[model samples]
Target: MSRYPVKSETCHEAVDLADTLLPGNAGVTRAVVLVTDTAQLDLWRALLTGEARTSAVPVVLRRHDRRSLRGWAQRAEVFTTDERLERLHALTGGWPLLVDRAHRLHVELGDPDEVLRRLADMLADRSAVRAFLEATGVYADPALAAGYRSVAAEFGGDQVDTEAVVTAIACEIGDEGEARWVFACLDALQVFDREEAQLRLEPLLQQCMALGV
Candidate 1:
């Protein structure tokens, strides 16, 4: 069920609903999939601990990749040129929410460039960046998130050096573990793929940084 908080009362209800939805609880055993969207995820973090721990696991769904984005775009009737499609994929980085919005704009307006430009603006907004960062599970602490946002502002969607990010947060927040958790959460969110020692930020996240949130 959607919009149910992961609080004591709601969780109890979720347990019953879990039994109702998946009687035997086959694969996940006592899990309730509450569908909702928000930038504040402290409630989600709460479910990871205490008595409700086993009953709920906060799992953010993975975004699409280039191949999947292309397929999704085609299905959405975003019939643009291959070059434009590549640009769209680069800008959206296969984030489903972004691709969904971009494609609709693409269909409505004939100019592919205009659509992408507008989409980039949307992603670059402060509120959008804050929401995306929180949703990635990387910024649990407001102070730490703020520090990292400063570093992102410096980079402005350019190639981000992973070590620099870690060191910067460590310096600013003065907590090595919390600093490292940023990358750890990003990994869990599937936002970046590490090739060798290089950690490449996905395009969607890069745009968020460009927003300077």
Candidate 2:
């Protein structure tokens, strides 16, 4: 119901134009919506909370229907009137307009610890664990590697073998260069102090040699 300074066609076209102009991963920091009807209001709400992910953007909606808009204002990071569209454009540029409407409602996603805990929980599945390790490598986090080592040591055996895990950690930490050095040293040694450790490191040595490391 709020009167927009620009024509309705212009405003609608702006949405499409903004999308094409925005860069990949360039999130919307702020957004202004010029609403003309109740349907548009509902559409905006859906966009802000729908299936599409948009936790990184912020939005401001300007409308003549203040009563309805105010009802859900708290759900959004910012809210305003159609008269302020130019100001919103100035502050956010075309990029903010391209933001996922739902994502623009919140400014901060959540706490880092909460995010990490969720990640850990998500990775608990054996398939997810394998996928994560393959994607991120063994030493993605040094603390995580140390924790794995400690846990493997305490458990012992194949269930949580220290040697295999350590080799994986070394592979991750040393990369090709370090893996090659460790592998070479292990191959050269005729007698190993720890048979288990030697057995574990031998495979890594073989892998390095095979890779021509």
Best by lDDT: 1
Clashing pairs in 2: 2-64, 47-102, 48-102, 54-103, 57-104, 58-104
Residue 8: error of model 1 in Å?
Answer: 7.1
If scored against the real structure, what TM-score would every candidate get?
0.60, 0.18
lDDT of 1 by residue, 12-94 (tens): 56554664566545665553456643333334334433334445556766778667677776776573568878888777777
Off by over 4 Å in 1: 1-31, 36-40, 46-58, 110-114, 120-141, 150-168, 180-198, 211-213
Q: Candidate 2 has what TM-score?
A: 0.18
Candidate 1, TM-score vs. the true structure? 0.60
Q: Give lDDT tens digits, candidate 2, residues 91-204.
A: 222222222221232234433233334433533455544543333222333433343343234333333243554465465555644433333322222111134443332222
lDDT of 2 at 114: 38
The per-candidate count of clashes, in order, stands at 0, 6
Task: After the best TM-score superposition of candidate 2, give how far the Cα of residue 117 lies from its true spot, in angstroms.
Answer: 2.5
